[model samples]
Target chain A: MTSEHAPIIEMRNIEKHFGSVIALAGVSVDVFPGECHCLLGDNGAGKSTFIKTMSGVHKPTAGEIMFEGKPMHFADPRDAISAGIATVHQHLAMIPLMSVSRNFFMGNEPVKKVGPLKLFDHDYANNVTMEEMRKMGINLRGPDQAVGTLSGGERQTVAIARAVHFGAKVLILDEPTSALGVRQTANVLATIDKVRKQGIAVVFITHNVRHALAVGDRFTVLNRGKTLGTAQRGQITPEELQDMMAGGQEMVALEGSLGGTV
Target chain B: MTDTAQTPEQDERVKEISSFRKALIRPELGGICGTVIVFLFFAIFAGNSGMFNSQGVLNWSTVSAQFMIIAVGACLLMIAGEFDLSVGSMIGFAGMMIAIFSVSLGWPVWLAIILAFLICMSIGALNGYIVIKTGLPSFIVTLAFLFILRGFTIFIPQQLENRTIIGGIADAAEGDWLAPLFGGQVGGWFFEFLGERGLIEVFERGTRAGEPVVDGIPMLIIWALVLVAFGHFLLTRTQFGNWIFAAGGDAEAARNSGVPVNAVKIKMFIMTAFCATVFATCQVMEFGSAAADRGILKEFEAIIAVVIGGALLTGGYGSVIGAALGALIFGVVQQGLFFTGVESSLFRVFLGVILLLAVILNTYIRRLITGER
Candidate 1:
């Protein structure tokens, strides 16, 4: 568990609510540098709400988030970004009509000042985008090509590379491989591995146990807005992880009853 | 990853196609070709009527200049994913403001011009604010302003002067240092030299005897060119321009990517308003008067020009240069019809047909480039 190294981010008893609805309750997790921490859950299991709180999309109703062993509170996603925590959302947050370089450096654009004018440093942006993407194993045709022409997996890789290049200490990916094809899923998983090797902590959220087993060093399962438990990679088997994610005996009994009626 | 990667061989093959052919497939290519075809069509049919002469060129260039000014603004706004239907009415309103302030209220022409810009830009900011705050389509919000401003253009003038027409703008603006910059022709000496050398026609019957009719380039054309260049640079070379494309392409995505989508869109609206005011300033100065009905249906003309320039009506893809060419095509067809001795009203039919054809061609080319099925 690398007890010698302090965890980069630690959450204690995190809780979130939307009006009368309890979206999450007492979900706690930890992310360490150079580790892929997979968060597994079923539909409506509050996995999204938990990550939203961690990434500053939503404020937790009651909890303590410690970043680098210091209590942290983010007012919004921008604050998280400034704090070196980057989240690549499920939609990937990409403008399809924009060029690769533009999308890559969107908010953190590089500029070249000429007298009184600050112009987008096209050559620098294009070169850095191409180089960073190449490091992620994506050989772009050119930085000026529209992102719409890229595959879903390539777009995800671009988002990951952008986060890494921007010096993110913790990269949170929300279902990065859910909509991808089999090969695309592998490509994205490989990109996550590459990101981890760069010493950035990755919070990989997914419902797919196989994908988690492939890249996860630790797994945290959530059910009905509460964390079931956390397990190290070698400590838990995929089948056990799958059952825990599906609610174990409760899910089996429901299936048995449904199968009998059918 | 290997499957997704483009091999160097394939990359080389992609480079094999000439950049010219690549350029030919761009959205603006249609506008360039359309401009050429339209220009040649008019030149061949209206050759005997001076359609190709300096006099005819100056006449159409003046009209094209006005449209180009607003079209560039419209093109930028459309790229930023919003519409300002109030631009036409904004012209009338801004013109009235200038006339009321300068001619009626006896303010300095420069002060009045600045005041008019401030007021128009405020209205534009309000338009953007309401659209963003209420989450309503800008089309609806600006459509309401279109009527509201048009009504005010008349009502305010009537309230102040007891008439809808505000006159003496030229007299009031006379002797002001800024007047010539916004109003007068620029290349008169050069044109006169050409006329003296018998290289260009010198009108024998109009104005002073044997004076060159074309004179210098109109201020409107100069302003239009400057704006086009500025708009092109802003859209292609600046981070703000990149934000504009992101804002229009997907507002949520742009926001998530840390782009100030709201700010970009609001600025686009303000720019459109500013352009409308510029148009009003030029027209009022050149005509020496302001009318409540000035710039009627000009919003449609600007949108048409933008669309013909290869911008999508839906937003996110366009160019200022293309828009300038679109305005030129419009000007040629409009003046060419006059030179051909055809009824000017037929210009509307031509506009409609050209818009339809250009949109169709643009869609086809976009499909080819994007490989959209």
Candidate 2:
């Protein structure tokens, strides 16, 4: 998947600042179509800021974002969405009390007109929601089931299926599996595999090394708001990637403090 | 039966049963039960006192109708996750505006009514704007409006007429084309027939030539039913209704999905104020006068009714029908108390108890559905 086709999105020296604090300093990464480009980083390592800039949550102080080989600027998340970029935040942005179908079509609902009145087409929304979730291998009991009753992995799957059904070209998922258990993590990784197969570019951001190694086609690591390097799968081992994510010098210092015991 | 031996009909029946069970746990179910219990209590205790008679029923229905008008609006606003404490004050202010414009300023009654609605809606919009712009809870913002509007209601009348009471509104509206639409009664012939046939008790006093004076269904009751139907439709069926649910459930999530939460809340506030004005207009036309204290404490009553209807105070869940039923319960208890020789002040205690019980029941039902505890 690497270098076989032109990159779908290319970021060059993206910098973001909040007054005197630098959230992202000269960080760059590229994602290709049908590839799970894992953004590997620890907390405060600028991974979130980078993802935010890419998804149009924030404007970069200095940088250029080329989407599909053309310069792109997004005023907000809606602008990014209209341009075929969708983001599923770490919080998931779902109303737990609402029905699954309602959550699936929250901001964009289907409507039918009767006489002079326009109404939410519940049948259409329910049928499409169930069908889309089924495509991701989730057999929902019913579209009217409250989302709050769903497991964490199922919720993440719903978000992924929603992004895909909405025609998202590049899906940016921020730390999707950080709060899930082992089996749930596997489910999310499997969903990512299904998404990748659909030729939609997926930027899977996470701090978990094993989860990334399981499904990522390529990995770009950030340390203290700066990119350490980008590596293709099989080019870098999981241990090497983990040490790099923790900062190579810090890992060395911790190892020395332990006296290389056992 | 073995797992694979079940027929499609059995599967369909299982689904139907489960769905029916799901419906049973809905928030409105509590309100429905409460309505039935209150009706039964009044029927058993106050039945012989004419509380169940046609005239007595009409009396309570009219009162409930007034409360329902504001309760439906409050229910919608609550569903959208906000409050309008200024609703009671808005009613007084709107009535004052209609009185001043129609009687004092000698304007046409219909024109005055329209202007009053527009002005009240603007104030409602302002309440919404301040809450959203300042990121303040609507409770605090509308609380401020409650006092501000109440003060104006009194001060404005004193400034213009040197009195707190405005009169002659009924006279101004008497022959107006819009008077019947907002102010008169229906079903007079039917009620007259009932009275003549001795099916309904004719009033001994306040009668004209041995005929019952209260011979029709008050227009307020009709307006309430219409508003309830409309509100229910808007909350459950429309796209805007979905937005209301989304906005109330989680404003940030709704906004992230491209629902304009701010606009929706503002519109809800405007509708609430519009409903208050409608109530005020009809009352003034019926009574021929408006007082500065016309709707004092009405805000709490509307909220109480809405809560009884099964809407969570925290927002995101409710039904307009439930609120209407809550209003009916309120009317029954209020008039029933009088008929049963209970002190009217006990009505306050009844409201307090019912509100607490409804809140507790609503929370319990929600937890049951969410499987929280």
Give me the candidate number with maximum TM-score: 1
- Per-residue lDDT of B1-373 in model 1, one digit per residue for the tens? 3334332434333445467876687878768888988888887889889877898888999999999999998999999999999999999999999999998999999999999999999999999999999999999999999999999999998999999998999999889987777798898999999999999988878557677878899899999999999999999999899988888888877777778888899999999999999999999999989999999999999999999998878787788888998998888888889999888899889878888888889888766554345
State the lDDT of candidate 1 residue by residue for A107-192, as single tens digits. 88899999999999999999999888777776666787778777888889899889899999999999999999998898888889
Determine which window of 10 residues in candidate 1 chain B has minimal summed lDDT.
B1-10
Model 2 regions more than 4 Å off? A2-4, A255-262, B1-20, B193-207, B210-213
What C-alpha RMSD separates each model from the true structure?
2.9, 4.3
User: TM-score for each prediction?
Assistant: 0.94, 0.92
Candidate 2, residues A1-262: lDDT per residue as tens digits? 4567899899999999999999888998989999999999989999989988998889999999999999999988788887888888777467777889989998778989999989899999999998987776666668987787777887888988888899998999999999988777778888888889999999999998888988899999999999999999999987788889998767767757777430
Best by DockQ: 1
Candidate 2 residues B34-119, lDDT tens each? Answer: 78888888888888998877778888898899989999999999989999999999999999999999988999999999999999
Q: What C-alpha lDDT do the candidate models reach, one value each?
A: 0.88, 0.87
Classified by CAPRI criteria, candidate 1 counts as acceptable
